[model samples]
Each structure stands twice: as C-alpha cells, then as structure tokens.
Target: MNMHIKVTTDDKDRALLAAIQDGLPLCERPFAEIGKVTNMSEEQVIARIEHMRQQGIISRFGLVLQHRPLGYRANAMVVWNVPDQEVDEAAKIITAHDFVTLCYCRARRAPVWQFNLYCMIHGQQRSIVEQQIETIKSAGLAPYPSKTLFSLRRFKQTGARFSTTPENERRLG
Candidate 1:
C-alpha cells in the first residue's frame, strides 16, 4: 500500500509560506495567481494551505483591517478590581465575551487606580465603549470598584506578525 507522505518543505516551502504570510490575493482566481509565482497548480496551492492549517502552522486566514478605517474610532483601556480568588475566573468570563477584546490581570495599584482586570474596547464613540465597561462592572465579578483609562489619542495601530525566531532582548514601541 502506498500511503500519502506528510507535507514537508525546503527553500521553496519558505517562499510559499512567505507568499501566504504576505496576504492572499483577493480576486476571481486568487489561487491561480499564487500558483503562477510558486510554480504550483491552483489545486496545489489550495492543498498546501489545507496542509499548513492541519499542521498547525497557520492559526487563521482572513483580512487584517484597521478598526478605525471601519468607523471604530475610539479605543479604551478599562480596568476592574477583581478579588484575588476570583480574578482568574472573572478573566475567563470577560475574555469569553465578544465585546471584551482584550483582558489581563495586572498587579493592583491602589486608591488611584486599583483595577487589575484590564480590557480594551473599540467603538464609534467613547460613550459606547464606556457603557460596555459599566455593564462589566455591574456584572458583580469585580467585587471592588473599577476605573477605565480611555485612550486620549491613538498614535499607531499595527497588525501583528507571527514568528518563531528568538532574540535575547526585544522591546515594544
């Protein structure tokens, strides 16, 4: 019996992967266009994509859009004062919600801003996202008072790039 071999790659694989990373074309024959460059048939291009996904090399494939371009102008970083015991559970609930885009537990800072559960929400107006934060506050998960630090200005919003490379030191700007 001739079993199918698992998909593996060489120099060409890196090039094909780079093409996929760059962004797939949005046209009537997107695969055909990619095939022209990779020297693979349209079917091969599609098959490779499937193989990449199955191998866990690709987490997802879709358009990367700027929220502001889509009319979502405001971005807010809201925080909550969740009890130590319930913080993990509360975070799980918050992260699961569709409206809560970002959630993390930071060390409690005190009277000035004691909220530890942080979340970021983007919307058309400040009030809309603010109300969402209020809803979360009233949810009773946060036993302590909470505060939100809304973004006064948006300097930059960039898409993330996934890589397997390692560096001794890296910084975010």
Candidate 2:
C-alpha cells in the first residue's frame, strides 16, 4: 500500500517520473518517446529507470493488462493445502502451467485455515476455467487438499504510483 518509493528527487526528475508514471507508450521505441518528452536520450532514460530500481526509487516496471477487457471473464483464486514438506515443490509445479498466472506459498492457519499454496486462473467462461482447473487437478495440481474462490466482483485493480506531494503534504493513516 506504500506507493511512494523512499528516494529523493529533484526538478530534472519531475519529467522523468511523469513520463514513466503515465506509462511508457506501447511501441517499439518507447524509450525514445519518453526521452523526447524528458529531453533525455533513450539510453539515458533506460539508465535512469535502472538506477531508480536499484535505488529503490522504483520497485517494478512492466505492462499493466486489463484482463476483463481482454475477454477473460472468469477469474478465480485457487488455494491449495499442500503438506509443509512438499509445498515448495507443489508451488513450483503449479506455477509452471499457462493457466496459472500467479502462484505462491503462504502460511497455514492450522485447525482454522489449512490452505497454503495459492494460484490464479482466468478464462473466457467459468466452466472453461473450472475445466482447466480440473485438467490441472487430474494432472496433480493439488494432490493434497484445495478450494477455489471465484471473484464475484472487482473493486479495484491498479499498480504502484509515485507520490507527487511535497514532504509536508503527506497525511498519516
């Protein structure tokens, strides 16, 4: 939830941050366009981005896709209960499938919550997604215990953004 990267910036950095935060243009020469706006060369822009990431001024850089707009209507977060000894291996296997977009291991709140490994799957329809999951399950997706939590609605989907406020303008939660 902390969007602002804890790093100092100057006037020259304003245009650079603006250019990137707005998103790089979807083209072969994205850096060139950004450089034109920032008055920096393509190499300079790329270098600065790399420097920002290294300095923790930027955490990530990648495309932000809108899955719903792309015809993927059904989306589910599949949680699985894998044994503590095999969770790592199970996670690795789950992450290998094309349908599984995100897969990671989480803590097991035993006696109350037992699922540990989680993955996300998407498809054009709910049945398709379920079928895909069954295929994976038949291929030993969980092999332990699992459940699927389909998203009934979407509240929000977004990526990180740099703070524009001055040091004095930030409000505490």
Candidate 3:
C-alpha cells in the first residue's frame, strides 16, 4: 500500500520553524531562549515541537559538529565491502566503537563501486584515527575489505532550511 502524508503549517508554526531551522542555541536552556524570541513559554516551545514531530512537520533534529575548530583535524570516511547477508552485523560492530562517529549503509554499483557500508572516524591526529580504524578491524571486522578516505578540507554544514519568506527572514534576523 502507498500512502502520503501532508503536513500543514500555520503562522505560529512558521514562526517556530523559522526560529529553529538554522540550529538551536548552544546553552543550558535553548528552548527557553527560543521561547523568548517567539514570545512563547519554554513549555509551549517544547509542546509545539513535539506536536510538529507527531504531525510529520519535523522529521528529525540533528547536530552539526564543527570538527576542525574543536581539534579533530583528522576525519576519515571508512568504506567497507561487506557481503549482503552480513551487512547488518558489520554495521552494528562498526557503530559500537566510541570513535566511530557515523555509520550507515549504501547501495553498491557492481563492476565499479563495491562498498556497501560507510562510517566516519574523527580524531585530533591522523595516527589516532588510524589506530581507531585498526581497533575496529580487530573487533571481528578484519575479514571485510575496506578503504579509508581522509578528508582534505572541511565544508560548511548546516541544518535543513524550511522558511524563505521575507517575514520569516525578518523574524530570524
């Protein structure tokens, strides 16, 4: 069966979305800071976010890390060629490590690109990240063929954009 859900947003909801579309404030009470801007209580901000999530208006909330500024200069995307039957187990093992920041599966194009699972490791130095990868390989994943592609440059990373109207821009400004 195929089903599609449409999310409707009002002005108040737009205001809330505008406030958070960039990124939440970095502080003890981020929602309270947002509440101050939107003229809503902290409880109200929490309730609206929850309601929006339930209604499918907000799919997810994520964190974007500025790794380089925090001394994590060595970041590598490790790709693994795991068999189809063992992809899940391989992913679980990779994600269990503390240094493994991200892990997910992707489709492989045969005869060209064969990697099916990918994970990221971030560290202050290249040797540390390499050691972490070695640790991961020691943890029952040594049999899989893998490649580590170190990041050469950092890119601008931000959250999803929801509002572009002038009024929303003014509110954000």
Clash count list over all predictions: 0, 0, 0
lDDT of 2 by residue, 32-95 (tens): 9999987899998888888777877675778778899898879999998887898777776776
Q: Which scores higher on TM-score, 1 or 2?
A: 2
lDDT of 1 by residue, 1-173 (tens): 11254545544445566556667788899988988987889998888888777765555667777777788878888777777888777877677668877777788767666777788888888888877776776675546666667667678765444332333112110
Each model's TM-score, in the order given? Answer: 0.61, 0.67, 0.69
Off by over 4 Å in 2: 1-19, 25-42, 50-62, 110-112, 164-173
Instruction: Give the number of the best model, judged by lDDT.
Output: 3
Which residues of candidate 1, in runs, are more than 4 Å off? Answer: 1-17, 38-40, 52-59, 80-85, 104-117, 144-147, 162-173
Better of 2 and 3 by TM-score: 3
Badly placed stretches (over 4 Å) of model 3 are 1-15, 25-43, 51-64, 163-173
State the weakest 10-residue window (summed lDDT) of model 3: 1-10
Candidate 3 local lDDT, 1-173, one digit each (tens): 01267766567677888788777899999999999988999999999999888887676666656888999989999999999999889888888898888888889998798999899998999998999999999997899999999999666666666685877666755
**Model 3 alpha-carbon miss at residue 152, Å:** 0.7
If both were scored by TM-score, which would come out higher, candidate 1 or candidate 3?
3
RMSD of each: 8.2, 5.8, 6.0
Taken over the whole model, the C-alpha lDDT of each candidate is 0.70, 0.78, 0.85
Looking at candidate 2, the ten consecutive residues that score lowest on lDDT are 164-173
- lDDT of candidate model 3 versus the reference: 0.85
